[model samples]
Target: MRFDKKIIKYIVATAILALSLYLSARQIAFDDLIMQLQGLDYVWVLYSIPVIIASNIIRALRWREIHTPLSTEVKTHNAFSAIMIGHLLNSFTLRFGELARPIILAKKEKLPFAAVISTAVLEGGVDFAFLIILFFISLVFLSEPLFKLLNFDSVFQGSLGIFIIVLVVITALFFIYRYRRQLWQWSKSILPAKFASKLEDSMSAFVQGFVSLRNPLFYFKMTLYTILLWLSYALIMYLVSFAFAFQSAIQLSFIDSIILVVFAGIATAIAFTPGAVGVYHLVVASIMTTLYSITSNEAFAYATIIHIITLLVQSCIGAIYLIYEGISTIKLGEMKK
Candidate 1:
């Protein structure tokens, strides 16, 4: 049944990927795209290399901090390797890295998998919260263009609807956390004693992973890392914006880079396909063409180059670390089990 479900998921992903590729490539001219790619400006992209690398480093640091409350002594190199491995896996399958990273890390570090996975869960939640905040901020600055881009009739209605939904979700989570003890008691009352005992152990480990969220110093440190991480992302965008042939046609300011990164970040986060392949390109190219006055070919070229470089860099880094850690294909497969 699990294998069947995995096959179904891959089929759905492939279909979506095909549709997105067709939509993005439909109006683009191959000749123009090639010309756009040929217009030489590799220097700026070279400048973005360190920033790209730094972003992932900061992410690994943040992940380490997330694990601090669990009292797990995860090596920095191991954490970094695990994150890159996740990225490498995610390039082929949507969300597969999320599961694989924790499993691999737990095995290497000799920690409980459930405990390590809870930190991953916390990392994801924090990232989603950050994205939501950034999205709303971008909405404030680029509301008019974004409204037209999305074809929303009323900006107020759309914003209010989204805000309410976010609020409700946050409130629900808060209530659950606040009343967790009571909820656990209720579950214990309903479940068999053996299963309830197991649940208690798992819940304890999970709760321990989030203990750092209660630390003031950790919160401040994490906020700084998150800010630096996103700034690195925006900086990379700004640097690469100069690499394209359309720089003379459309000037991208720092604020424009921020807005672009915000949208791209949201697209990448929510996209379900491998490495957000077609979805990322479409969102990026659409924004550039619709709002930045960049031609479709140039926009598509820019998106394609960025995605390709990102995938190559991440895959290379991950491969190196996998070798360093002696993580073979068989090892990875065994980790899944």
Candidate 2:
């Protein structure tokens, strides 16, 4: 019997959801975990507040840098509003924020969605470059025991992993260049005529999405901003490690925290669910367990708490900004055309 691809996707997604829940549960007993939380440092979590906000602020500035070549300049506060609300909207909805974020700026700031999306794509390169630098740096200083916890060492066994990453990146770049025209043609070829026209309309607005690499200053700023953002983020993660007073067995340092954070972020960026539902917990738990010798239960406690805190805090903050700005985020999405 034939089956629908959409149905298969949902089936697999559901399976992943189940797996995530099970793994999370094994890390902390439902009731015991709740009790453990009562003794936990709410204060420690608060310490992360400034770091988180500063990181996002830097990101907003970095975004502007990425978009500099496109004749669009976003003020920092305005950029923060876009970033926060977009983070909220995207957390709840899948991939919609990717479009919604640019559209909001395009409307309020009179920028084009294509230009903003261009900035996002251009910014992606900065993210890639920084992650490689941080990951490799961690690998150089860390021993096999510590490397297991950060999850970078396994990715390079017998040189096979390094070859694969290089090959994949090169292959991706080549195909992008090789199939540039065909990518558009392929989109047009598959969809119905009316839908194809709409797709073309959307694709047309993608002007600044990939061309921002032309200027050295723009790339330099992108790199600088990304380093700032990730470093701040890693600092927060390291603080979280210290908060427990029990991470001695985990054996992580400042740089090790940096490596783990980078790996977890990249893994979750490709996650099956919004906010990297399953991938975040799994990657984090594995890092703690393998590298730090953290028990699965303790790792889950750390991962789940961090994930929930980040989402709840940011989303609530973003919602307030949306209200203060006097625009309904849901309604903002309706203006997509």
Candidate 3:
């Protein structure tokens, strides 16, 4: 029997998630894990929910800002609803949010899909750049802890390695943009007429997606929102730490939360499973246990609690928006096309 590619993707992703779950829990003592859970202060968990929601809202707002150069008609509510629904989809399917978000936004705002998609691509690039910067900063301040967590001989080696790769990529992209017309002409000379035209069309659509980046004001707003969004994440981490005994016993400071954010961000970037489920748990639990000398049970409990809170909150909000936007299964299929 023939299997669909998506079915295959899901199978692989699920297998990875299962392996991650096993690895994350293998060292934990279940009885101790339960005790750790029982001792958690629910109040701090409650406090984290709003901050989590606010971060996503901030992301939606920044997405709306990205759309401004193309179409000012995109409403904040629609943007929020669309991206939330996308996040909801991402929880179950790998990378589906990245694909579905632009379609949702385009349909809701009555804008061209290609134009809307360009903005999503731009948003991703911008977020990745910010993550790199934060990752570098975290490496500087928490090199010892990170080394302990990753068991690396020298953290700077990996940092510099990634920095070199990023520099190469940026240089290549700069040259590509600078000489786009000549490259197009060269391609047109060698390619079939129909293929060349299609390539040109795709390139034009991709370029249109980044129109907002040209505005200095957009950069200012983007930087501001990005800072606020990451800060909210760090804040949520801080609040959730209070629920764990380690917070009071060893005093995991705000810097500790920031450091954890860096770890979580790395997990998010490299995650292969849906919603980064098992990958996030393992990375976070590892960081906690390795850096703080916490028991495996406490570390896993901490990781699981925060992951559940964020997942539950985003999923619920996304479900509400999914209904509000009237995105039925049929529409989802159409968007996939």
Candidate 4:
């Protein structure tokens, strides 16, 4: 990894956060926010435990949908173990679990690495599709008119713009799914440099990892799982919101939860940090305050609580499984063998 790039990215991210606080602090009550958070009944945080854990179980079942067409099967329990452990690790390294997940399962279950990895990619595609749909739905609930000065809606009103965007994405996704190997070869041919050779091989493997999604049923199942997984996520948020009387009129409402999830998804998609780290906090807080009219402290408290609860629940479960599998961090080297 490029240490310099990594350091620079963190510094940039921190700077963005500082700017966010500076801008919001003038309008929001910092002290009140803190006091509100202090006054919050922490028992509500605990309520998230079951919801988050249940979401993971549903996630495992959903993942099975992605791999069925590839003929790469994994038991739900096994998939759950791999998913949790890989995601926990991914919290420290952006996109790391994209490959780590299948590799871990392949090692443990004697499954094919390529087959498992391909299924993971298929799952990702389905997740993206649903997220996009959710985002569109959120826009309707918000139902706010554009600034009008920009005439942005006029520009995007017709089918042409949507068609072009859809066309580009479809074209890119198609090439990636079908010609991944050839594309990798093409990249090498164009670059054809000595240092690029190893990088090419690694990337080729990564692309090849998604080839199993080529099957039609893989797409179908991936679709089903994506919608359900996100629905499960939103439901958990709703339950958590109710646990604390988060807000009756605005905060934690059904539509509000959907909106938050949509914004969080958009923000986290481009977040380079592990588990989106500061990015998740910033986006969730900003949206809650802006759209839901939540107090700054209330917004921050809810976001922080959810993030911590989700992580702790996952970590605990993954820790137990790690011990059961006899795969401690120190022993991870053995898995690759």
Highest-scoring model, TM-score? 3
Reference-based lDDT, residue 237, model 1: 83
In the predicted model 1, the residue pairs found to clash are: none
Tens digit of per-residue lDDT, candidate 2, span 163-187: 6887898899899878979987987
Model 4, 161-194: lDDT tens digits are 6557878999998878699778767777878488
Candidate 4 minimal-lDDT segment of 10 residues: 141-150
TM-score of each: 0.92, 0.81, 0.93, 0.76
For candidate 4, report its TM-score.
Answer: 0.76
Residues 109-162 of candidate 1 have per-residue lDDT tens digits of 887788888889888877777777788787776446766665555657777887
Q: TM-score of model 2 relative to the true fold?
A: 0.81
lDDT of 1: 0.83
Q: Each model's RMSD to truth, in Å? A: 2.2, 4.1, 2.1, 4.7
Cα lDDT of model 3 by residue, 105-133, tens digit: 88878787888888988888888888888
What's the candidate order when arranged by decreasing lDDT?
Answer: 3, 1, 2, 4
Q: List the residue pairs that clash in candidate 2.
A: 27-297, 114-205, 118-208, 118-209, 149-291
Could you say which candidate leads in lDDT? 3
Candidate 1: residue 175 Cα off by (Å): 2.5
Comparing 1 and 4 by lDDT, which wins?
1
> Candidates sorted by TM-score, descending order?
3, 1, 2, 4
lDDT of 4: 0.67
